[model samples]
Target: MQIFRQKHLEAVYRRAAEMGPDVARSVELQMLITPKAMGIFKPGIEVIAPVLSTSRKEAKEAVRFIDDSPIRHLASITTPLIPMRTSHMSLVANVTHFPPDVRWCTDNIWIDAPVNNVLPGLKHIADTMPPAPNHSLRLNWQPAASRPDMAFSLESNNYLAVYGAWTRPKYDHKYENWAT
Candidate 1:
């Protein structure tokens, strides 16, 4: 994991604080655009998912579960959001880093699951297993966002944290264009 400099973290927090409580509690999950969607990978399609966890250990476990499950085919890639202090308010900061202005919420995993399988899979997962360690896995789904453009405009606009992905072989080629 890349350690964010103190100044950068403070900036993010400062901006987040200005959004107020409703926005902070409302923002959850991170948005993702696949390499193909961004025109980086040929023959790939855009897929999005809520951020499962900021914790590397927990995120890895969720990915492992997906890789070992039948739904693995629906998942394209799992990426990390810029790490932030784990707090409800920080969710606002986390989401400030995506595009397409929108506000809604859902507890269901929102990755690239096909329309046909999404509901059934969500039901099955809800019925069979407890929530993930971070409690990210849930049945009731709601997404929220107010001012998303602030994410791209941040002084340290490194939202995706692509540098920390270097250890994951699957993401190696996908993020070449994002190299600093």
Candidate 2:
């Protein structure tokens, strides 16, 4: 019977890998394997109570300080077995007693996040100009974190942002795109 249970769990794991994390997480919630006896979700919840408390806060202040934290010291080691961080933090090692790689993509994969991945930016311009003779506009753009050229570019022939009066014809304007 135990062997059959383990096989079922293995099948669930395979389903999680192929179907996605949400489906995998919901796999056979009725039956949970434990040493004491086959129990329900409530006992499992008690096994890692501290992790459940972290949901009270908005920012994840509890997670970063969870390991060796004065309040939830034991929870850091108990988190991995609970399957809470399996979606994103599975590969990111810190307090959990797990490997760098959890062997599956647990979270949404960004195709254009890598340095070599070239994702073309999209920009749009209004067809009809707003009826204003002064041609004044307000811009509320902040400094770019990584690519200044992408956020505030001087070249208009090809760009990821809409070209306005500020960057009209020859890039000559009262203020530079970078606010120089």
Candidate 3:
């Protein structure tokens, strides 16, 4: 899988580190797959996972799980599926107290396909395999920052609901919906 550190965001990380131990401790190592890698070219389907939260060892285990799963194969029927890649190593701030509470996120793997085509496979995987080791690593299915919609978190059992929400039409926002 392709992996790259976002050199541009390094200053944010460094600033958080300088905020003392509390703020530093709040930083989490996250992994996000690109929309293109997931075969999603649309605006609303990006997904993100906080895979490497606590340590590098945990990150390796999470990476191995993703690499071996059917998740990497959720592309179109005609096109060959692309392998999962590390979009970036995001320093996500878990606490709101921090000034730059950066939340690095993306779309669902099956965003390009119809919900009917995608949900069954995800449901089967969720049923047969164990829940994500760390419950916190669940997928965040959300629209792009430009859209006016609420972001939903998908737990192991709630995969159906998350997929169902995607079928809804986008709505106009009265206020700014700014969780990117």
Per-model TM-score versus the true fold: 0.22, 0.16, 0.25
Better candidate by lDDT, 1 or 2: 1
Off by over 4 Å in 3: 1-40, 75-156, 159-180
Which residue pairs clash within candidate 3?
A: 45-107, 46-106, 46-107, 46-108, 47-106, 47-107, 47-108
Q: Model 3 scores what on Cα lDDT?
A: 0.27
TM-score, prediction 2? 0.16
On the 0 to 100 scale, the lDDT of residue 74 in model 3 is: 40
Please report how far candidate 2 places residue 117 from its true position, in Å. Answer: 27
- Please write out the lDDT profile of model 1 over residues 1-180, one tens digit for every residue: 111121232222232223222232223322221222222332222222223464766655543422343333343343343444558535643442232332222232223333343435323322332111111121112233333676533221112211112223554454333322
Error of 2 at 73 (Å): 40
Of candidate 2, the 10-residue stretch with the lowest lDDT total is 131-140
TM-score of 3: 0.25
> Which scores greater on TM-score, model 1 or model 3?
3
Error (Å) of candidate 3 at residue 36 is 10
Q: What tens digits encode model 3's per-residue C-alpha lDDT throughout 22-135?
A: 222222222321212123332112233334246665555544433443333442222212223234222222111111422222223323334354445433432332111101
**lDDT for each residue of candidate 2 in 50-117, tens digit (9 for 90 to 100):** 23333435223333332333333322123432334545543431222223322211111122222122
Which model, 2 or 3, shows the larger lDDT?
3
Model 1 Cα displacement at 28 (Å)?
7.7
